[model samples]
Structure formats: C-alpha cells, structure tokens
Target: MNSKVINEIKIKDGRVLTLVEGDITERNVDVIVNPANSYLQHGGGVASTIVRKEGNIIQEESDKIGFVQVGSSTITSSGILPCKSIIHTVGPRMGEGNENEKLSKAINSCLGLCLRKGFESISIPAISSGIFGFPNDKCAKILVNETISFLKNLEDSSAGIKLVEFCILGKDTLQAFQYEFEKSKPEF
Candidate 1:
C-alpha cells in the first residue's frame, strides 16, 4: 500500500493515464493486470508478489483457465486483494519472437478483456520488464503508446474504462513510464 502518484495524463475522452510508484497488489482499481506465464503460474516478480498478497485462490482460478497464449489474457475473481478482479496476461520473454509486438498485443489484450468485463478502472504493472527481461525503456514506450491508442479509439465515455494506471514498481521502471507518458501526452 506504499504507492504514491508519480504522474498522470488526462486523455480527451475524460479517461486518465496514471503513473504510480507502488505495489499493484495494493491498488484499489476495479481490476489489476498480472503479467503471468502461459501456464498462469504466479512464481516470480510482480506475479509472485500478487499471489503472495492475494493468496492461492487467484492461482486456483487461473489453473482452471489453464494455459493462455503469449499476447493473450484471461480473467479471474480477486481472492483477497481489494480489487474486484484480476486479469492475467501472458507476456513475451526477452528473446521471444517479435518481443515488441508480442508485448503490445499482450497489453492491448489485457485492456480489451477489462473493457469487456465492464471494468471502469484498472492498474497494470510494467509487464515483461521484470523477470521476462524486457528493457524498461522499451517496455515503457510500447505500453504507453498502446494505452493511448486504445483510449483514443474509444467512441464515447460509455466505453467503460475511465482510468488506466501504470502501477509500476522500482525507480527505474517508474522513471521509464513517466518519461514515456510525458513524451506521448498531447500538447495542450
């Protein structure tokens, strides 16, 4: 729960892009995206932290969904966390095929799933930038770009998402996302 706001961008549709230096497990958004393995295993990095805080039930439900393809995602009810649900997404490893494209697809898929579930707000970490070894700056650029693109495509406020947060961990990741957000935000 030690998260503090680092930065924020208000999109044209009234939605927000937030950058926070904190633990996603403590975020109170409607959903929190977990960067998980295709097997839905919560064994390391942010995934492990989430499982440690939320308990085994998150993994139990994920196990039912079994395996998810890289760049794809699925959802499960939050076990003990404050959020209502968790969206587990499989992110690509560093040397995986077309790492950048796979990472972008993974984030877009997570956001798409959240919208379909009617979630108005979600907190996401820097997927694949941790144990998956994707570079923080590259991760920042792709994630922030895809997020802005997704929000800009919303036809109206009723698209169901009003907030998308990059609940990043580590000072380096936080800075990376912050820089990307600043660089991409519209000149107003």
Candidate 2:
C-alpha cells in the first residue's frame, strides 16, 4: 500500500515541506530522523521500528556513539534501510523543565546535522509526541516553525538540503500536523 501525501508546502526558497501519512522508516529520503532517548536505545516507539526494519547495524553504530544529550542529535549509518543516514535526536519529556525549548533544540540539531552532511532531503516524525508525551499540537507547531525558519535562514540553499518531510503515522497525528501547517503563515 502506498502512503498518501496529505499536504505539501513550497518554501519561498523553492524547497518543499511535505506531510505524509505512513511509516517513517519506509521513507526513501537522504536521511531519516529518529526521536530517540538519551541512551540511544531503540527498545520501543519509532526508534524500535527503525532499528527492527533497518537491521541491528543501526543499533550497533548507536552503541558506539554511547549517549546523546537531551535536545541534541547524532547521526548513524542507515543499516539496511534505503536512506543514507539516521539522525537520532533526543527530545524532552513533557514534564521535564523547559520542554518546549528542548524540543526545539532537538529539531534544530537534526537540521544542522543534515546541513553539515549535505543531505538534499530529510524525513522526520513528531519527536517527543509519543512515549516522551509531548502534546501533538505543540509538536506540530514547533516542528513546522523550526523547519520553515531553517530554510529561510539559509544563505541561498547552496547547502543542498531541499526537502523536509513530516512523516506522520495514524489519522489523528496526521490531522494535527496538517492543521498546524495550515495555520502557520510562512515568511516566504
């Protein structure tokens, strides 16, 4: 079965922010962002799905990295997955102090890593919205804003990161992201 794209926004710089309803691990982008824990363990949630589908090599590379600070991100080989890399970002737990800020940092960290690696496209899920318990609406807002700002700040899109896709699973989350995307007015 093919995943349907629910929305597509064209950045003023000519890049795209796409919203898709599907399994994120299946996306064939240059990079896939994983909402991981500080320990870099893939025991459950989106992390587990990627590790299981991609192969143990992903986890092995993660083990080598050891730990990632909350709101920080690290990259690992994509293992058997189609993407070139997996960016493991550790977002904040809802009750944690400054949850909003932490989530923003986590996302920015992922984008920065993508720019550094010169990845032309990247796919991300709603980080911290699952077991980490961040509000879905809030997750959507921050993600959309951060991505738009990231693209806007680029000197001239010379870094090569062109597409940023939010791959949401389930109907409710997809709706939340789509709604937020609609409400947000991109700067152009």
Candidate 3:
C-alpha cells in the first residue's frame, strides 16, 4: 500500500524515467502495465493482485480479448484503480528461447501501446521476473535499458509520453532497478 519514488532521471526531450518502490496496481498514472500470461489469466502473481484490488472487470475484459502472444500486449479498462487503463503484456518464461529479446519486446509493446493510446504516463513492473522466473538483475537491466532507448528515440509524434515508472514490489527487485537507474544516470 505504501509507495514512494526511489529514483528518477530525465532523458532526451524532457521525458522522465522513474524507479518506484510500491504496488503497480496502486500507481496513480494514465496507465499501468500488467505482466500477464499469454492466455490473459489473472490467476497468480501480479496479475492476481491487480484483479483483487481493481476488481473482476479486468479479468472479464481480458477473457473477452482471448489470447495475447508473448512479447505483445493488449489494453483494458482499469476497473476501480486510479489509472484510466491497463496494458496487459505477455512476457516470456525464463527457460524459453530468446528470453532477453522476448522481454525487450514485451517492454517495447507496452511502450508502444502507450504511444498509440496517447497515454503520457505509465507504471510497469518487472515483467516475467515473478512466477515466470526471470533473474532480477537481468530483468532490471533490460527494462531500464529498453525504456531509456524508447524514451530517447521518441520523435514529435511520440512525444506525448512524459513519464515512465518502474513500480517494483520487493526490496531486491527495487534495489536491482535502482542499480540499473544509477548506472544509467550519466548517459542521459
């Protein structure tokens, strides 16, 4: 329930990248990214948490959407949450081939959805790092780097995205993201 901004950096074109210690479901932003399975099941992990807090409308909408491919995403109403919408993205499992590329694609998909929807702010968790078994450090690094690249490459058409926050839960995950942000600070 308690959430706080741990660190942040300004990237090219005045985009803000932030690391937050909190529940992604509680983020007060335009949209929140859900690390979902291909089937859009809200059965466990962060998916279940979002359902429990936001209500079953999210699951109902996901059920209507049917299946989303790994490294892709879909959007749904946010139910009772503060945000307006949710971007449910499927991330690859750890043992799957090309895990790194898959995770990167997942992040890109979320960001792309944000751009298309004209959402200026979003909160994302460490995709595939929970029940899917991705390494915390690797997830942190990929998420940080990919987000930075996306923000930096934004042109006039994609400039609506002003804020991106990694709303991490566990201490270790938060620390990993913090480390990545700190390491990337000088480059931006």
lDDT by residue (tens digit), candidate 1, 1-188:
58898889888768899998888989989999999999998899988898998888998998889989999999999998999999998989999779999999999999999999999999999999988999999999999999998988888776689999999878888889989988998754
* Candidate 2 residue lDDT tens string, 1-188: 47778888888667888998888888989999999999999999999999989889999999999999998999999988889999999999999799999999999999999998999899999999989989898999999999888887888655578899999996777888999889775655
Ranking the candidates on TM-score from highest down gives 1, 3, 2
Cα-based lDDT for every prediction: 0.91, 0.90, 0.93
The parts of candidate 1 lying over 4 Å away from their true place are none
- Measure candidate 2: CA RMSD: 1.1
Ranking by lDDT: 3, 1, 2
Instruction: Give the Å shift of residue 65 in candidate 2.
Output: 0.5
Stretches of model 2 off by over 4 angstroms after superposition: 185-188
lDDT tens per residue, model 3, 83-131: 9999999999999899999999999999999999999999999999989
